[model samples]
Target chain A: MFGGYNRRYKHFSPTLGCSMNFHIYFPPSPPSSPSPKFPVLYWLSGLTCTDENFIVKSGAQRAASKEGIALIAPDTSPRGLNVEGEAESWDFGVGAGFYLNATQEKWKNWRMYDYIVKELPNLLAENFPQLDTARHLYLSVSAFAPIGNPVNCPWGQKAFTNYLGGNKADWEEYDATCLVAKFHDVSATILIDQGEDDKFLHNQLLPDKFSEACKKHGVPVLVRLQPGYDHSFFFIATFIDDHILHHAQALNL
Target chain B: MFGGYNRRYKHFSPTLGCSMNFHIYFPPSPPSSPSPKFPVLYWLSGLTCTDENFIVKSGAQRAASKEGIALIAPDTSPRGLNVEGEAESWDFGVGAGFYLNATQEKWKNWRMYDYIVKELPNLLAENFPQLDTARHLYLSVSAFAPIGNPVNCPWGQKAFTNYLGGNKADWEEYDATCLVAKFHDVSATILIDQGEDDKFLHNQLLPDKFSEACKKHGVPVLVRLQPGYDHSFFFIATFIDDHILHHAQALNL
Candidate 1:
C-alpha cells in the first residue's frame, strides 16, 4: 500500500460486553513530516451508523492521509450482547446507542459512552505506537449531526426512555446541548454542519438547541446550515475534509 | 455540499427480474469549464461487493468531482430475488455475479452483461440528461478485481459454470484475459491495480494472466501490482484518483 494499512480490529471491550469493531486509518508518514507520532481523531457516527460508515463514505481518508492525521471510527453501538429487542428496531436497541450510558437495568451495560471516551483510546494508544500518547484524544464538535437528540423523539426518545429511564434529566450527560455547558474542552472549537433540508430535522435532530447551548455557555461554536443538504452521508462525504482540516488545525498540523 | 451529490436510484431490471439499486455520483461542474453534460465512468466492483462499496470506501468522489467525471456504481449481482440458494454462499450466489451473462437454463436470465453494457446506459441516458449520450457508458479496466474468470476458478468457476453452462468457450466472452486478444477497443488504454499481497490472489484472482494477455495483444495496459496491499477498498482508496485520471484521459476530458 502507498500508505500504511487502514486496519480493522475486534477487541474485547470491558465497557460494552460485546466485541466491538473499530476502523483505524494511520496516515502514511511523509518524508517532510517525519514524526513517528500522529494525532488521532475519534469519530462517533450518528443513529443508524456503523464504524465503517464514516470512514467508508465520508471521503475523509484522502485528507486524513494528507494531513498525517489518523482516524479512529467506532461502531455506533454495541453488538453481540442481546440487549432485549436490539435487532427488532432500527433506532432503539442496536445501531442507535446515541453514545450514551444506560441508567436502566436491561441495557445498563450499553456503555458506548465509556467505550468511545476511554476504552477505545486506551486500546489504540497501547496497540498503535504511532499515536502521540501525551495529546488529548476524544470526539468533540467535529460531527455532522446536531448534538442533542431533538426533543427526545424518534430514536432518541426510544433510546433515552429505554436506557436512561423516564427521567429526562438523566439524558443530559449524553445530550450535546446539555453536555456543551459542562464540557471542559475549552480549546476545541465546536464545528457542526447541519443540512437545512435534512429530512430528519423535524423529529430526529435540532441544531439550534446545541448552537444555543454553546452560545449560552460562551463557548465557540460554528453551526453552518448548508442549504439543500440532507442527513445522509451525502452531507458527511460533502464536508468531511473540512472537518478533518478543523481537526488538523487543533493538532497543530 | 462541496460536490453535486452521490445520488441513489432504484429501477426495475428486465434482466435480473428484480429492483436494482445503482449509485451515481455527478461531479460538480467547475466554473472554468462549464458544461451541463459530463463524461462518466462505470465502476464494477469485485465479489461480495455492492453499488455502495466503491463510492463509499474508495474516496474516488473528490478526484472524480475535480476531474468532472461522474461515476456509476452498480451492484455486483442481481438482488431482491428468490434465486435458488442465492444467499447460501458469499461468492457463488447473491454478491458474486462475476459480471457475466448466464447461459445455463436455470440462470440464463442472469444477464448482468446485458444489464451493464446495454440497459444501464440506456437507463442513465433516459434518467440523467446531462450525460453525453454519444460516449461509452460501461465498465472497462476500472474494476476492483481481475476479469475473465482467470483460468476458470474460485467464484468465477461457479458463476461461469452455472451462469454460462459448463462450456469453457462460453466464458471467454466475459474473460478479460481471453477478450484482450479479441477486443477492438485499441484506442482505450487498460488500467489495472492488483495488490500483490491480496488474500484472494492465491485462490481466486490471477492478474498475471490478464497482464500477459494484454502484452501479447499489443494493447496498452498498466498493471500496477501494489506491494503489500490486499483485496480490499484500502487499495482502491489509495489509488482511486489516478484511476479516475486514466478514465478522464480516455474520455478526452
Candidate 2:
C-alpha cells in the first residue's frame, strides 16, 4: 500500500463558474529523481461527474503502482453558479461538459474541448516531474449518450438534437470521431469500450463512428463492444486491466 | 469512476492480533449487461502500509477503467493488539509482513503468505465475479531489504525460500540453476524490476538469484535493473508502462 498527496488548483472555465477545481495525483517521488520525466494518462469521466468521480470510484491504484503510471481525471463538465434551467435534467447543465467548447448563446463561454484536451494536460505536465506529457492517452466511458443517432430508440434524436443545438455540424467538434480526426497527430492510441445496451449511446453509432474517424486518420483504436451490456462502471472495471496493458504495450514498457 | 461497497472481515493471527481488513472494489454493472468478468491484478504493498496504501497512492484508475481490469491490493502486514514485539525494528514489525509466514516462536502466527496467496485470492474470487483468478499475477516492490550477500540480494533468496516452503522436502525446488525447471509448473510469469541503487534489495542479489532460480526451474524471469535508481515508487512508476505491456504480451491481449 502506498500513500501520496494531491494538490488542487482552480482553473477558470468560461462555461462553468469560478469555483471549478481540478486535481492532480502525484505518486510519491523522491526529491533526487529527474524532473519533467513521467508519462501521463488523461481520463475523461462520463456525464454527471466531477473530476473526483474516477479518482474516488475506480479501483486502479494497484495497476498504477505496478505499472508506475500517473492518472489525470478531469470533471465531466464545468460547475458553480447556477446557469438558469441548468438543473432541469440529469443529462445536461452542470454535469454534462460533453467534451466540447460550447458555441450556443447560454453556453458560449463553456469550452470543455480546450479544458480537457489542452489545458488539463498542460497543467499536469507543467506541475509534475513524474508525468510524461509526450506520451499520454485519452480515455472516456460513453461520453456521447444523447448526441448520436438513437437507432431503435426514441430518446436518441431528442437528446442529440437538444444537446447539439439542432445542428449536426455542431456535433463535429465535440464528437470523439471528429476530435480524433482533428488531432490525428496525437501519439497515444485511442481506446473506447462501450456497452451494447447503453441507453444514451446507441451501440451502433458510437463504436462505428469513432472507428470510422480513427481509421480515416490512421489512428489505432481498440474498440470492444460488450454485448447486452449497459452504461456502468462494472463494464469499465471489468476491462481496466486490458486498458493498462494496452497503454503499457504501446509504450513498450 | 466506479465504486463498490466492501465489507470487512477479521482473521485470527496468533502473532499479529485481530487487525486485518479485506476490501474488494466492484465495478458498477449496467442493468442490461451480462455477468461481467475481469482479470485480477493482486497488489502487495511495501513496508509500513495497510490495504489502503496502494489504493490511494497510485493513480491507476484511468487505465484500470479503460482496460476493465480488477485490482486487488492487500495490506502490508497485520496490526492491532498482542502482536506487539513482532519485530524489534520497523523493517520487521507490524507493518512488515514481508509476504512470508513466520516460523520463529513469537512470530509463528504471522501467516502473511497464506493470507496473501491463499485467503485473499479465495475471498476475491468468491465475492467478485469480474475477477478471473486463472489470470492472476503476483507483484512486489521493495519487498525485502538487503538480507544476503550484497552480491546475492534477498529477493531471489526469499522467493526461492518461499517456493521451497510451499513444496517442502522437494530437492527439485532447491535447484536454482535451471530457469525453466524452476517455473515449470507455476502458471503465472514472474516479473521483478529493481533499481540498481535500491537501498533495500541489493541489485545483484535479486537479479542473479532470480535468474539462477528460473534457469534451474526452466522458467524465464524478466528482471530489469534500472541504472542509478533507488528504492522509491518513482523508479517503479518510471517503468510501470513496460510492466503493463509485459502483461499484455504475456496474455496475448
Candidate 3:
C-alpha cells in the first residue's frame, strides 16, 4: 500500500529576507482522477509553532479524508541563522513569525501576510493539482467553532501582537478581521470558531472585530465561542466532523 | 479577550501493561452552566499519528462549539520504547500502534484497545469536567459524514480497516460495534460520507460492510459517496455544519 502521508518542501523567500518552509498534506487520490481538485484550508499556527505543529498534532486526516479537503500548513515565521535573534526567545525568535511582515529592524525582512496570501497559495496551486486555491478558507476564521475549545495562552497573544506589531493601526492588514473582507470578494461565506476563554487572541478581539468587518462587507460569518475550553488540538479535533460539513455547505459540495 | 484553546495530558494503563498518552478536546460550556455536561466524540488517528493530529488539522472545534460536543484523541500506540521494533519504520514504530495490542512477542505489551476504550475515557471523565461521559457518541462507529468531494485515499482504507478491526472475531473487544452492544445496550445510528475518488481506502468496503453489520444489529447507517474529490480536510470542512446539525438532531441538542 502507498504511504498515507507524504511531504514536499518548497523554498519560499518571505519579505523578512528569510527562506521559509511550507508543508502540504495530500491525501491519496485515484489514478483515474489524476487531476482531482480539492478545496484548500489554509491553516495559520500560533507562535512557537512551525508548519509541522498542525501536521503532527491535529488528528485531522480521518476527517480530511472523509471530507476530501486539502490542508496547507505554513511555517509561522521565516527562519535562518543569519537573522539576529532568530532563535532567541519563543515569542520573538524563529518559531514566532506572527504571520506579518515586521517593520522593525532585525525583523523587517519578514512579510508573512504577503507570503501567506500570495506566495504560499501560488505555490500550492502550481505544485498540487488537488488543491482548489479559488475556494480557500482560513482555518483561523473558522476556529471559533465550539468543538476546539478555545484557550487563553501566552503564545497566541504574542503571535497576534507581533502580527499587529506595536501599532494597533496596522491591525487591519494583519488582523484576520481585515483579511476576511478581502476573502469575501472571492469566497461565499466565512466561518470562525473561537473559545471564550482563549488567552491569546482574546475572544472579543478576534470574533467580535472580525464579525463587524465581515458584516460591513456583507459576508456571512459563522462564529462560535466555545465556553470553558483552552488551547490544544483536543479542542479542535472534537468537532472536526462538523468543520468538514461547514466547508461543504460553503463550497456547495 | 479570552483565548480559545485547551491542552491537557493524561496517563493511562491499559490491559497490555503499557502506559499510554491521550489528548482530549473539551468544548467550552455555557458561562451560566459552568458544570454542564456535553457529548463526547472519540477520534482515532491512523498510523504514525498521535492524539494531537486531529486536534490541530481537522478543524472540528468550530462544529463542536456549535453542537456542544467534546472530542477525544489518543496516541496510536504506547510510548517509552520498550517494544522491540518501537524505533523501526514509520508504519510499525512508535507512532504506528495499529490500534491493536501486539499478540506477537516484543509487541505484546502494546494494548491500544484498552487504552482507547476503558482507560482513556476513565481518565478523560476524571480530568475534563465538560465531557459528558455518560451520554457520548462513539465515533468509531459509522457516524461519519463526507465533507466535500471525496477522493480515493488511505483514509477510506483506514476507516474500513478500523471498522473491520472492530468487528473481526478476535478483535470484537476493541470494536465499537461490539462495545456499543455489550456495554451501552443502545444501538447507534451511523452516518458515513465518502468521495468516489478516494485513493486509499476502497469506498465500497466501508459502506457495504458497515451497512451489513448494522443490519445484523438492527441499526441505521447512512453513507454518502461524493464525487470529483481527493483526500483532504476540505471534504469534511465543507459539510461540517450539516454534520453538526445531524449530531444535534440525534442528541436533541
Candidate 4:
C-alpha cells in the first residue's frame, strides 16, 4: 500500500495578481529511492469550486495513487478579489472561470487560461521536482459537470461579457466546440461522461456540440451517457477509477 | 467489488429539536436477495467539524466498502439555531457539541447525546430495515484527534460551563475519563488514534488522562500514537484503512 500524501500550497501567480490555493497529491512512495516522475491528471472543476472541492470531495486520489499517477486540482478561478460586485454572485467573476484567457480590455489581467495551461504546470514542476518528467508534458482536461457552450449560456454569457467583452471571434477561443474545431495536431482521445438525468442536460451544458466538433476534427472522442446520474461529484466519484485509467492510458503510462 | 454508495439525509430530529444532516454510506452489497445487514462504524468528528467533514475528507468509505461495513457520520453539532452567542465562537456553541447532552437551564433542550446515541439509530433502522440487526445494537465510537477531557480543557471548559452550567457533577457525564470510570457496562472495545505531533496535545486535548481512566476501569482500550501526524483530516486519511479494520474487528464482522 503506497500511502497517499496531500499538500496544500499557496502559489503566487503574476498572471492573475493573486496567491492561488492548489492541492497536489503524491502517492505513497518509498523514502530512500529517488522519487519517480509520474504522469498528472488535471481535474478541472465546474462552477463554485475551489482547489479543495474535487480533492476533498471526490475519492480520486486512491485510484491516482494506485496507478502512480499524480493528481492536481486547481481553483476554478482567481479568488479573494475586492473588484466591484465580485462577492455578490456565485457563478460569475470569481469561481466561474471558463478556462480561457480574457480578451477584453478591463478584465485582460484575469489570465486564468495562462495560469492553468502554462504557469501552474511550471510551478508544479519547479516546486515538486519529483513530478518533473519531460518537455512534452500536457494535461488531459476532464470536468465532471463542465460548462459546454459558455458564450451563450446565462452564467457563461455574463462571465464572458465581463471577462472577454463583446467580440464574438475572440469568444471562440474560450468555447470548447469552437476551440476544438480550429485546433489541429490533437492526439489523445477526449472522454466525456454526461449524465442522462442531469438537470443541466438539453440546454446549459451542450456536450453534443463538443463531441461533434471532436468528431469533425478527427480527434477520437468517447462520450458515455451514464443513466440516472446527476451533476454532483457522486457521479464523478462513481466513475473516478475509470477516468484515472482513461488518463493513464491516454498518457501511455 | 461492492461498489459504494453515499446518501446525505436531513432528518427532523426530535432529540436536537432541529433538522440534522447526517451522511450514511452503504458498502457495495449485492443487488439481489434481501440486503445483508452490515456492521456500522459510528465515526465522531473532533472539535469544529460537521457531518460532512469526515465523510468528504477522510476517504473512509473506500475502506468501509472494502470490508462490507457501513459508516454513519453525524454532524459535529446541530446547526441553524440563534441561541444568543451560538454563532459567535467556533469552539463554544455551533460546531462544538462535545458529544453530550446539555444540562444548563438555557441549553436543557440541547439533547445531542440522545440524537447521536439513540434517535439517529432508530431513524436509520426505521427508514432502512436493511440496517436493522440485533435488538441490543451498540455503537463503537472510534475517534481520531478527539477531545480527551472535555470538562478540563479550555475549549471544553467554555463549552461545559455554558452547556452544563456551573455544576461539576453534570460536567463529569460528558467527560470521557469520568464517564469511562463510572460506566461499568462498556460493550465495545474503545479505539482511539491520537497524533503525536498534534498541536492540541500540549493543551486543550490530553489523551493520557482518558487512557489512564480506561485502564483503571479494566476497559479494553487501544490508543495508537501515530507519529508525525497533525490534527487535520489528511492525517486521518493517512491511517483511515486501519481505523476501518479496527471497527470491523470490534464488531466481529
For residues B67-131, could you state the per-residue lDDT of candidate 1 as single tens digits?
88788889988886777887888877788887778877776557788889889988988878887
Ten contiguous residues minimizing lDDT sum, candidate 3 chain A: A144-153
Candidate 4 CA-lDDT value: 0.77
| True-vs-predicted CA distance for residue B232, candidate 2, Å | 22
Local distance difference test, each candidate:
0.77, 0.56, 0.59, 0.77
Model 3 CA lDDT for position A44: 79
Write down the TM-score for model 3. 0.53
Question: DockQ: which is higher, 1 or 3?
Answer: 1
What TM-score applies to chain A of candidate 2? 0.75
Poorest 10 consecutive residues by lDDT, candidate 2 chain B: B142-151
Number of the candidate with higher lDDT, 2 or 3 = 3
- CA RMSD of all predictions: 3.4, 12.3, 10.3, 3.5
Off by over 4 Å in 1: A16-18, A31-35, A85-88, A138-140, A149-162, A165-170, A182-185, B14-19, B29-35, B78-89, B136-140, B152-157
For model 2 chain A, where is the 10-residue window of minimal lDDT? A140-149
TM for every model, in the order presented, reads: 0.86, 0.46, 0.53, 0.85
Top candidate when judged by TM-score against the true structure = 1
- The top-ranked prediction according to DockQ is 1
- Better-scoring candidate (lDDT), 2 or 4: 4
| Model 1 local distance difference test score | 0.77
Tens digits of per-residue lDDT for model 4, A49-156:
899888766777778877888788888887776677766688776787778787766566578889988898888777777774454655454555566777767777
Question: Which portions of model 3 show Cα errors greater than 4 Å?
Answer: A1-253, B1-5, B12-16, B31-34, B124-131, B135-140, B143-187, B203-207, B212-219, B233-236, B239-244
